[model samples]
Target: MSKKQKRVLIRILISSVLFAAGEVLIITGSNPFNEASLFAFFLIPYLIVGGDVLLDAIKNIIRGQIFDENFLMALATIGAFAIGEYPEGVAVMLFYQIGELFQSYAVNASRKSIASLMDIRPDYANIEIDGVLKQVDPEEVSVGDIIIVKPGERIPLDGVVKEGTSSVDTSALTGESLPRDLSEGNEALSGCINLNGVLSIQVTKEFGESTVSKILDLVENASSKKAKAENFITKFARYYTPVVVIGAALLAIIPPLLIDGALFSEWIQRALIFLVVSCPCALVISIPLGFFGGIGGASKCGVLIKGSNYLEVLAKTGMVVFDKTGTLTKGNFKVTEIYPAKGATIHKDEILKLAATAESYSDHPISTSLKEAYGIKIDRKQLESVEEISGYGVKAIVDGKRVYVGNAKLMEQCSIDFERKTTPGTLVYVAIENSYAGCIVIADEIKEDSADAVVNLKNAGVKRTIMLTGDSKAVGKMVAEELGLDEVYAELLPADKVNQLEELIKQKRLYGNLAFVGDGINDAPVLAEADVGIAMGGLGSDAAIEAADIVIMDDRPSKIVTAIEISRKTLKIVKQNIILALGIKGIVLLLGAFGMATMWEAVFADVGVSVIAILNAMRALDVSRYQG
Candidate 1:
């Protein structure tokens, strides 16, 4: 618990004890009204519990802010004291304090969860000066400086590893369980832990431009962007408070003057009840609390909701658009199928081996997949004069025989007749001595949870799932079919992707809103253009994450379903509180004005409804029950 919460709790305990002691004395034989000593004794506990409230009411009155809960509460309790109902006045203040404590506690709990996210801020950096390592503030380190990170230290800024190798625990940023292995020439982001082995990194970004700094800035400023529901409540309270105060004042004055035999004291009591019942505490306290809890719960699951407004819109999403590479697929090329052309003398294994040998000296993704598939170490001495034909493939002499590995363009260029194959991947054609050999199909592997992600999204009421990719139409169609997507738009440039998303958003407008998910630097614009921009924070570019309203920290598309579920549940809770508070207060207000309800019922309508609504709002924090 926070210190402020502890103090509120302590005040609650003290007030409760004093109120109990005062009640005991009243029941034992002390006449509060007749005996000065007894009245002072009872008044002591009332002042102990309500002194602060009365002082706040006076301050608000002096500042021209007279129509609020504090003012209403002070007016009602003091009116009860004037009527010699000391016990009722004391009870009203006591329960009001109790409700305030609950609100304070709930808000504090949410702030703590968000504060935990801010813990990723790095404190210092270790820079080498003349072969001596010195720890200094991370801001002092500049780009291109070599910073040494030891075991169990957070990487202070974004950089590339120049020396040594280690595993980095990226769970704090990504929310994944696996540690990413890092070696020389690999990029390392800030806010990740270097697990073991010393590493010398060449910094590529300043502290302000680093990934951690950007994320922290985004989170800290999130609450300034309020949801529609929150804005409605603010406007409602502003108008509602003043209207009820005027009505209560009219009730106290007009009834006694117009109606014969209507005593001023009795009418004043009814007006006081009206004021208490119309405080609007329940709606005012619970709506923002519900949204705050939703954001906190999303953070716990590695889904950072930038604001309640996005959370609200996410719940209304009917269509979900995705970028194929890095968002739906693993973005890593792998050899999934190998086919040899008809009439080829060489076997399937030989085709792969030759292609692997020709591409062994290359560092392309397709080349890496071929080498990994070969599984046998290549002897560089046997390969001679490897030459890369841009946009086609590679040419090299392997085992004293000239080998060629590339696409159909390469075959057409060499006038070598090759058999065409139907497959949804990047096919690398092989040839020896200008004769057609075979082909190897390499593709970006789909993530394991992608299929499940689609299923869960449909179950969560997502009407359409679409994919946009820069790959061939064949590859895009294959992935769309595999993932059960509704539509696929392929061969798109970054601008084409944005246009396609805009069209989809327009098409889906009649049904509901649309959400776009992506994870590359190229995806930043589309991420911002969508109804709700969701970025894969774990491996995503900083630009993409910054433009996004929601970030999936673990880079799992399935978490999109989880985020939608959380927003929907939070909206449900908020609506429940609003209806419950308004419904009950509407009926109680009529009863109080008609003199049918007593001060006890007015207290329940004021404090009791607030407490119940707050408890319901707290349900948004228990997000574990939501499996999606």
Candidate 2:
């Protein structure tokens, strides 16, 4: 318990002892004072437990902020004392204080659960000067600085490993417990704990731009964006409190004056009970707490939701559209097969050699794959004229022979007769000395979890699973068929992708949202255009991440399904809290107004309902059951 809560506990104990003593004296017929003196004696315990609440009500009244929970509580208890009900008044305040203590503890626990992610903030960076390591604040560390991280220390900046090798724990950032191994020349992100060996890292980004800083900024500002349900509760409390307060006052005064033989004390007691039951504390506290717990739980699963508003929208997702490369498939291209033309003098190795040599100077992904497949040094002395034809391929003279390396379009442009391959990959046709030589097939590999992601989405009740890609129709069809996507739009440019997404958006169900998933710089436009933009944080460009509403830290498509599940579960819990709080309060409120309930029932309506709803909200933070 916090110190403030400790003080409240101490006050509660003292007041309870005093209250019990007075009741024992009254029951034993040993009361030492008259009615006036007894009232003064009971005032001591009432003020002890509820002084702050009365003081707050007075302050808010003076500041023109009436009709809050404190005001309702103070007014109800004070009216009890006016009607000579000293013990009942004291009991109401004591139980209300206990409820307040429960709320304080619950809120603190929820903050700690979410703030666990803030533990990733590094305290200092270790810099070497004059052959000795010196600790400096992370903000003082600049780009291009070399920082040394010891075993069991958190990495302070984003950098590449200059020397040493070790496994680093990325659980704080990626929410995965597995430790990633790093060697020399490998990229090391900040906020990861160096587990086993000391690592010398060359910094690539400044402290402000590091991954840790970005994530911290995202988490700290998450609560500012509230969901529609939370907003409704805020407005509801604002208007509901004043209306109930006025109703309670009319109930106290008008009934006794108009009804013959209606005792004023009995009607007044009923009005006090009505005020206590209608405090609106349960609805005011639990709704926002539930949404916050949901966001924290998602962070624990490697998904960063920008706000609760997006969490609300994700629960109603009807269609999920994906960008093929870097989102569903690994963007790395590799040579999967090789085919030499029939009746050609060139062998498979020779065909690869000529293709790799002709495309040596180019830096395209297909060129890099060809060079890696060739696995030999290209002697540029064998080349004479090298020319790149846009929309085609590369034309060069290799070993005193004219070599043309490009697509089937390039072959037709040069009038070279080549056998077209029907394989599901990017086929690169090659021609030497104006004759067909061979074809090398390059393909991007699919991610392991992508198929599971599709299956889970369908199981989760997503109506449409679609893919939008800039790859050829054949390659796109192959990946879509393998993943069992409901729809596929292929061979599109960046603008064309947005157009296709817009068309898909029009086809979604009413009250349902569409989400676009992409990871490239060109994907920024389409990501922004979607109802919810999900970016693959790992290996994704800065533009895409900036435009996205949610980020998947480890680039697993399956986590998207996890996010949807978390969102729907959160929405369910919030609805339950709303119904639970309002349902119990409504029944007791009507009973209190009709004189059918007493002060104890009023306490249960306000305090008991709040505690139950708060405990239910805390369940949103337990996401372990949702993880694989």
Candidate 3:
């Protein structure tokens, strides 16, 4: 706990004990109304509960930080005491202190929510060297060094497994709540807990570049990025306290000299009631509490919002655009079909092996899939004189035989006539020793939940869902139709995506906010250009998190709908609290100024409204109970 919290807790305890003792004495046939006895019965508990506020007011008087709520509350209660209303004075302080303690308690609840997300961060890592497990800082471990991950332990780094296999639980990172199978040559990331096996992994990234550490950093700094609301109460206090103080001074001095029936003390008493009623505590206390609850709730559901600014914008998003590559697809290419064209000489395995070897030195998606499909050992040493043709494909010599691998254009240039086939994905033809071989069709598979995500967003009141991709129009249309998208803009470069966003923003309906969801490195510009940028499938990419406004931590496209629904609900609660606090305070302030209400009523106007507003703000944290 912070020092301020400890001090507040101690004061509450002291007040609780003193108040109990005072009640006991008053009930035990003691003479309690005497100055000495009444002082003990009322003043002791009041001082314990409200002494810090009084002290703070005095300090502010010395430091020229006067005219705040502290001074108003302190002086009003002192006026109550001067008028022989000891119990009323004591009640105000007690209620105010209870409100303060509840404020602290609410903040602690929100902090606990943030602390739960801190589970992904590891305190230390185990580095294996020469068959020995040595404890070391993650930063000191280099690439290719084998790290040991034990059962019930989070993976400390992103690495490829060199030994052993395990069912690793990655729910913390993905929120999918399923354990993924891992074995030799499979990749694993930090924040995944080992379920039941000992695995030796070759670290691929530096500790500074690990995914869990970045996520922790994001969650820690998310609040700082959120912009605050208008803070209407603090603004009211800024002007109200000084105005009331000045008006009371005028009433205390000028009115007594002019009016025949007016006593300066009576006007001063009225001024004290006015001050007590105008503390502006309700708005000041509830706005921050509402945001704390909202952020805490989002963190629990695996949606990390950087600040209140994004939270506000998320509520206004009208059109949500999705990038077709990684955001809407699996982002991994797989062989969907193997077609040996009519009169083709080589079979499926021969075609796959030739293409895999010819494209071995390339890093494109189709090349990687071809390498995986061969099901044979890839010895780069055997394929000598390998060369990559920029944006076209590759040319290499496998066992002294010239091999060519690329699109139909490259194959046509090499004089290899391979018949075209009906395929919705990227297809590559292969030529072995200048002889025409069969084709291997590789397609970027649609995400498992893409259709459901689109449907859910529509149900969540999103008017339009669009897909923007660089792929051919035919392929883009096919994917869009399957996912039930409203529109598809294909063959778009990075600049073209921005153009589409501008057009959508111009034609946007009621909310006037358009969102673009993407995960590619090139989509950073578009992410920044949109009104609300949703980065989907952003597990380990820093660029996606930095450029986007809302990050779907688990890369689920459906989270976009979840975030919007949560934002809509949270914003509704926040506004309700604001209206509720002001409505109650406005009526009570009028009654107190006319002398129809006591100091006790004024205390409720100040502290009672605050407590209710705070309770309402807690609704933002209960998204599961509220969000469908």
Computed on alpha carbons, the lDDT of every model, listed in order, comes to 0.79, 0.80, 0.72
lDDT of 2 by residue, 121-168 (tens): 899999998998999999998888999999999999999999887778
Estimate the TM-score of every prediction: 0.67, 0.62, 0.61
Per-residue C-alpha lDDT of model 3 across residues 1-628, encoded as one tens digit per residue: 6677778778877877776776676678674567766865778878878888899989998999887767766876776676665655665666556555544554343232333434456767798667788888777889888889888888989899988877786544542222466778889988788877788899999887886665555444443443444434446656767886786566557766898998888777766666666655666566666765776687677776655556667788778898887788876778877777678766888778777877777655566788887868887776888876543567888877788887786787778777877678777777777776767788778988899999998888888899888677877898999999999998775556666777877876664578888875446556667776677635524555566666777887877877887778778877887788768766876676556778678768877887898889888888785334
User: Clashing residue pairs in candidate 2, if any?
Assistant: none
Better of 2 and 3 by lDDT: 2
Model 1, position 378, has a per-residue lDDT of 87
Runs of candidate 1 with Cα error greater than 4 angstroms are: 1-230, 420-422
Q: Model 3 lDDT vs. the true structure?
A: 0.72
RMSD of candidates 1 onward, in order:
8.6, 11.6, 10.8
Tens digits of per-residue lDDT for model 1, 1-628: 7787687677767877877877787788763546566557657777877788899989988999876667776776776676556666777777667656554554344222333434678999999888889999999999999999999999999999999877787644543223556778999989889876799999999999987776565544432332233455445646776787789889999999999999998888788778667766676567767887898888889988876777789999999999887889887778998877786668889888888988998765677889999999988898998887654567899998898898887888888888888798877888899888888888888999999999999998999999987677998899999999999998765556766877887786576888989886556557667778899989876666766778999999999999999999999999999899989999999998888898778768877887899899889988886544
Off by over 4 Å in 3: 1-229, 232-262, 337-339, 342-350, 357-365, 374-403, 419-425, 432-438, 467-478, 488-509, 520-531, 536-540, 625-628
